[model samples]
Target: MTTNDEARGEHDAPSSRDPQDTDADEYRTTDQHEATSPIDRRDYLRTVGAVGVLGVMGGLAGSATGSAAAQADWETEADRRIAEHRQGSLEVEVVDETGQPVPNADVDVEMAEHDYGFGYVLSANLLLNETEPGHPYRETLKEDFNIVWFGNYHKWRFFEENQEIADQATAWAKDNGLDIRGHVCLWANVDAWAVPGDVVDAMGVDHQSGESGADLDPQHVRDRSFEHVREIIEHYADFEYEGTEYGSVIEEWEVMNEVVHVPGMIRAVNGVPGEQESDDLDPVTAPVLAEWYDHARDVAPEDVGLATNDYNTMEGSLEYARSAYERQIEFLAENGSLDYAGIQSHFGDRDSAVSPEETLDVLDRYAQHGVRLRVTEYDATGDDWSDEEKADFFHDYLKTVFSHDATDAFLVAGGSDAHHWRDDAPFFYEDWTPKPAYHVYQDLVFDEWWTEASGTTDDSGTYATDAFLGVHEVTITVGGESTTEQVSVTDASGTTDLVVTPGTSTSDCEEQGGVQVGEHCARDPDDDSLYEDVNGDGQTTHGDVNALFENLDSDDIQGNADAFDFDGNGRIGFSDVISLLRDI
Candidate 1:
């Protein structure tokens, strides 16, 4: 299924090397050194007819990519193509949800790992600034990831316990331009280590009897839960120093988390206390859940997107999971409080791995309700798999997610294995060396799906460009500072136009790896793996050809063979392969 910025890292090699290896540089150059013959497009086309294009393209298809120098030459051509297709200008228009142009506003656009944001669960300690000097992969989040959710860390009680650490985590993410989400504000199991056990237990135990074993009052539990949530959100979301209001750090939040798991203060579902057989709540539980959602929504400012978050809510194949989500969507849709329907997709066992079709179906089903969607917590946990298999899983799974228009973001529940919520994550190992998933992620996010370019609009308030299908951060620069908004540069025919005003200021906007003029930074063309042999067989032969073809029409960084486009055209065609054979 073709999805949206619907595409999809490497790990640390050395900080001293190119930082993008940390995510900085991303341009591919052709392999042609001064000693090698230049690429001749006409000759390549002529030879393709004589030798047959398929044989040329397929013969050494299984081989590795071209030599370093040849790869560089191809990279140069690819970069040229990207530049050539840069029909879209840097100016983008800001609009409210109603589609009206939001003019003259301070707009800031930055790219998230996923259109939403992707990475693992974040611990305050994982932050570089939060850690002591010489922490492992200090810039890993800044380099590779775009968002961090505090699953095991940054909780209400945890914050009260470790405000400094939580503050540091927020500071680091804010500094690096990463988005953030708070896991849970309220849950039935608040007594479980998430918040202060003493506080939650005290909420239930009455001192009137002068004993710890007092019966819990549902209303009392609800009141304390409300107060706790209010304080946390007020502290983080609507921060104030003295009478001056500081901007909020968290823009999105899990207003009611795992409501189906245990109805915290709700006490009963349809008159049943602690209904646990399935995720669906009884009539009693549903209303109470909605009340909590309303309360949380009321506590947060209008800018905040309050989400109804749950695990396995929409695997489709699972009967209870689908039923539970359907109920939640129905209830939230009615309440008009469902800003985001957060789904947790944890694929632990092979059987639990939902197909792309099933995942898309589920997401679409929810989309019909007109609610914003997010994959709040996700992890594909399969054992005894090769590195290639893991990488392949990450690519295909995300492709399915990216293809969907409603997908706001996708976050993995874990990051590094050493500091993971579970056993493993696709991007990291215990040692912090990037896994295969990391490389594939880099190719997709920074390469195939990323468009680093610039253009100017006509007399009309519009700028257009031919962009690959994906979500983009279109930052319109006004004055020296910049304003950014997330926009979609789609694959539809013709040019993708943005409707924002760029200030006349000549100040240049900062970008990650692409060439940058004033107010525009074309995502830097990746040049890192340009000369890499696909199969690592030490030759550019059948294995390489096979790899390139497999990725044909795919925006996958490891798949697209722009370097093989000998004609220096935007695409890889018959002539490109002939040119490769000549080089081989």
Candidate 2:
């Protein structure tokens, strides 16, 4: 147990250094040819910004590397890079409280954050631990958290595997104080050809002349979809899994998975190509989404939140930024299915990873709707990055997640390294021993952040201390006649003190947006302001700079003059206009 000294002053929260400021900046690789050279694969990885999340549905089965735009510049660039390859590297410097290097002392540190709960996706083996009396995995699971995303317990697993596991797992979570979020009701039709292949195939309605399929009726498919919702909610809601009345164990459901990229969905259903518009709600996409939401809400009991989960929402992909976030917010706002915005955060090895500030901005964007947010399926991926780098990224990502009030939960997509979906998962190697990320998780969750401490009275007859903000149980022992007090530690300005009447028995407490439809929130779109693409040519070029100059001082600006306001002078004058050109 890592304990803080009550007499001493408070230490800095977890990481003293910025997540981006690691000392591994100058290192260059000499063994460039050592990386297995795949020309096309390497290129596609770079081209499609975040390919790591595409395989989210496949579990350990990997996903394809290509994007919707088939083979193009990504391939050409990869061809160039693969001609002379260089392996990327990652490193982490472990230091002690005194600012000296610590050489491997088997450290287990924990720092607690806010009400935003941390959880993991329970693999089948991990789920099996629910029945175990005292297994190591079970102990670890319970020790860290009681919640889990029941891995592969979807419609397919419901048919193929023993239903006992689902029952027992859910019962265990309820029996324990964990909240369960059921993954999805409808995965993309392209993703539905697995064990529950028959079920998914049966729901297929041919879009031959905007009518139902010859094999399956549209009404029948709709009925089955509704029934599927009813069954899942009812089974978990009313039935007991392991001889325990498992009432209301499931707190939320991800009504639909990734409909944002389902091919020809908008064209076939709504009479508009999915790629044609910047709009999320066209005629076709709207009804299907509405049905899923209606079915889930009608079947589920009250207070059970419904969310439409998707990937690349916060991965900073331009396509997703246009197609996914803005449109989903508009639709959810209309339907009230906006209980939680589920953004899957995953990393690809070849591309640059997302920053903490970028992710927080995404959170702020979604919080504009007043909907709770969850880091739905999270994995810090990439074989190119060292284990330490992954840990560092996870550390920073989580720090931002916990600090935000709008966030409700942050759940990892997999449990163990051996059972992860992508090869570039939490850790590189396959061993049960905890990795650096694991240790970071522990140190943050248990040691530094958790609220639990006890010490004898100081010379001042008081224990002056600080801790995380939460409802806490404090005790004062005066010669075996222990007096316990219930207190809430929530002082925003500084350390909150808990005191007694006679003397100062002080306990310290640690202190811790609107959405736009097509454009950036709060940005006036009379001009194309965000990308500095003033010319509307889809590319930022010299043309844009010329367009800015031509339209200067005139009320009728040619493009988004505001985006080119580089000098922050609040106007598109020469200084601001020329600055964007020079920077470009």
Candidate 2, 253-346: lDDT as tens digits: 8776655544233223344422345455553246667767877888887767888666566653435343556577667657766587777665
Compute each candidate's TM-score over C-alphas. 0.59, 0.57
In candidate 1, stretches whose alpha carbon ends up further than 4 angstroms from where it belongs are: 1-116, 128-137, 190-192, 198-214, 240-246, 268-285, 314-316, 453-464, 468-584
Off by over 4 Å in 2: 1-114, 129-134, 155-162, 189-195, 203-216, 263-285, 319-323, 350-352, 427-429, 452-471, 483-584
Q: Put down candidate 1 lDDT per residue, 1-584, tens digits, no spaces.
A: 11100010111112233211111111111121111222232333344332342233233321122344643554454445333432233345444334455444443433322333555556554443223433433455555566777743455555666666666666656544566787667644432344354444444532221134444445555666678778778777644333322246675777666665545445432323332243454632367667767877888866777777766564425666567667778788788877788887655544455555567678888888888778766655556445555555555566567656677577765545544444466566665565655655666555555555554333333444445444455555444545443444333434544554343222332222222222322231236424323322223443233333344344442234543454355555433433333343
RMSD of each: 19.5, 25.0
Local lDDT at 101 for model 1: 55
The count of backbone overlaps in candidate 2 is 20
Candidate 1 scores a C-alpha RMSD against the true structure in Å of: 19.5
Residue 224's C-alpha lDDT in candidate 1?
A: 65
| TM-score (C-alpha) between model 2 and the true structure | 0.57
User: What's model 1's overall lDDT?
Assistant: 0.50
> Candidate 2: lDDT of 53?
27
